[model samples]
Target: MKAVVVEAFGPADQLAVVERPDPEPRHGQVVIAVEAAGVGLVDILQRRGEFGFSEPGFIPGVEVAGRVQKVGEGVDRGLIGQRVFAQGSGGYAEQFVADAAGLVALPDPLSARNAVALGVNALVAHFSLRRAQVRPGEHVLVRGASGGIGLLAVKMALQLGATVTAVTRSTAADRLAELGIQNIVRRDRETEPAGPFDAVIDPVGGAAVPALLGRLAPNGRYVLNGGAAGFPPPEFGMALVQTFFNSLTFSTFSLNSVPAGEAGAAARAIFADAVRGALVPVVGPVFRLTEAAKAHLALEGGDAFGKIVLEP
Candidate 1:
């Protein structure tokens, strides 16, 4: 088996492609013959040593879509050859092992490529909308609406029958328009868009929170889960003050806190909606497994429009 190894961990070029031992499932685990894997900002950060705890010489990738080749102790043999998506470390390889508890079988209608596209980003958006309790006819604002997760939220909010206000750069207008999202704002503009939105889905957090709060309806909910602009801004007190003054709701979403089984269930639900033509994932540039380093470069340079995938 071959894998992308973060050897020295400084730049994208440091991600080396090398032969590695094929992974075997331990008790209660499953090994996948990976078809595709998703590249993310976290992968880039790990490549750059920004994640201080990530040491060198580790295979990195959190989510992947493939077929189950083998099942371990206490696992059903019937699961073998099932097309599944699982979350775990070492996804950037031909063979990856993960907990069987985290695996979800994909219906025949979905492909491995599309499954990887709709992986984590879509899950985060789904959980965010649920936390915000977005309802039909409500007006929702989505900041960073052009990014992978932000764009997903825009489409989901629309499906929920909410009026979506997408805040993105002018470059994204044509793309958003193609998605039927007509209400778009230019992020470079100094002025905020007019809104007393029923909910605000903010992926770009930091000093922008206070301004986003102003857009929400009096009793509206604001779901903060991403840090596209950056995290832990100099101050976070404004949300506290605003939440106190208004009968507003502040909520959060994290895959880490939620159990793996729960995440897999939600993903299957979303995939069913996808198969029904209710939701579609936007896939951008793709890389071969050996080109993992270049994929990280494109992501670091902000070139990925929706989801970046690696085909093994």
Candidate 2:
């Protein structure tokens, strides 16, 4: 087996692909022969020693889509050779162990590559939308709308019949337009979208928070998910004060903070949307497993247009 190891967790070079012995399944576990792995900015932040609790020398992928090669005790033998998406550690390799209970069975219409692209990203989008109780005809605002999770939020918002305005870079204008996003605000060239937005899905936290908060419609909700913007806005005090009179809701969410069943349902919904053609996971650049360093840099530099996948 081979794994992309975060050797010392400092720079791009610190992330290297190295040969390792294959892992065997333990009780209630399954070993997946990883077909493709999703590359996310959180992975980059982990490589940079800025995200999660992982230390150096850990393999750095959070989600993978592939075939089950072996099953452990109490696991069904029939699951062997099945195509599935499973949440697991060490996904940046050819093989990794996943608990059988957490696996999402992939449908025939969804390819392994697309499953990896959509897996965690879509799960987050689905959960976020559900949390916001988004209504049809609501005005929705999606921050970082060009990134992997952001793109999915856009798709889900559109599917919900919300009028969505995407906040992204001017470079992403054409791609956003191609996706049927008519209104866009570039982070560099323009001001944030002035909403009266009924729901604001902000995965990009930071100096933008207060501005986005101010634009929210009275009684509107802003759900903060990720902080890819690095630094957060120093307006928590004001955000608290304004919420009182505006009757607004400024909330935050994490899939990890939820119960196992709720999280699993979200993951299952991601694939179901793909199978029904309601959403298409946008896959950006593909990298060989060995090219994890380049993949990390591309994602961190905002060069990856959609979910980037690394194939082993």
Candidate 3:
């Protein structure tokens, strides 16, 4: 098997492809012949040493889609050859070992690439909106709306019947419009969108926090799901104080807080929606598995419009 290993986190070049012996599944685990792996901002951050979750010699990817090649004890033999997607360690490889219980079977209509693109991203968007308590007939703002999770958040918010205003660079406005998003706010613009929104789904936390919070309407909810740009500036706290009289609600969310059974059910529902074409998968740059460095560079460049995936 070929796998990408983080020899030492610094630059994208640190990711090196090397040959390794194939892995066998342990008890309650299965080996997947990885078809595709999803790449995100976290991968970039981890590679740059900004997120120190893993040490040297670690395989960096987390989400993958493929077919079950083999199963260990306590796993169903019938599962072999079933298409599935899962979130686990060492996904940046041609083959990955994952707990059989964590695998979510992919419907026939969803391709492995699309499944990898939508898996964790859909979970993030779905749970973030739930945390924000987004409802119909309200205006919602989704910052960093051009990235994978951000794009999914925009679509899910629109489906919830909220008037979604996507905040991204001007380059993405036309594409977002094609997705039925009419109210697009350009982050690069000199003028900002006046929101007073019912809720704000922000996946990019940075200096923009204070201004976006100011746009929230009285009693509006704000949920911070990811910090792609880094932590909120010191003024973030002051921004909340300034909006004190608005009686606003602010919270942070992670899939870790949700029970496994509940999240699995939600993921299945999301997959069904994708199968029916209610939720479309947006795949951006596709790179070969061995070109992991190039994929990381593309994501760090921030020019790609959707989920960047690596095909093995």
The sequence of per-residue lDDT tens digits that candidate 3 reaches over residues 149-238 is 999999999999999988898888889988889989887884667878999998888877888888889999999999988888876777
Please identify model 3 stretches exceeding 4 Å from their true place.
52-54
Candidate 2 per-residue lDDT, tens place, 1-312, comes to 989999987888899879999999999999999999999877878888988745798998999999999999999999999998988678999997999988888888899899988988887887888788899999999999999888899999899999999999989878999988998888889877777898999888887787777777877888888889865656565865766788888888777777767777777776787788878888999999999989888887886788899999
Task: Provide the RMSD of all predictions against the true structure, rounded to 1 decimal.
Answer: 1.8, 1.4, 1.2
Q: TM-score for every candidate vs. truth? A: 0.94, 0.96, 0.97
- For model 1, the superposed segments whose C-alpha errors exceed 4 Å read none
lDDT of 1 by residue, 90-173 (tens): 889999998988888898999998998888889989989998999999999998787778989999999999999998877777
Determine the backbone clash count of candidate 3: 0
Q: How accurate is candidate 3 locally (lDDT)?
A: 0.89
Poorest stretch of ten by lDDT in candidate 1: 231-240
Q: Tell me how far candidate 1 lies from the true structure as C-alpha RMSD in angstroms.
A: 1.8
The predicted structure with the larger lDDT, 1 or 3, is 3
Per-candidate Cα lDDT values, in order, are 0.85, 0.86, 0.89
Q: What would the TM-score be for candidate 2 when compared with the true structure?
A: 0.96
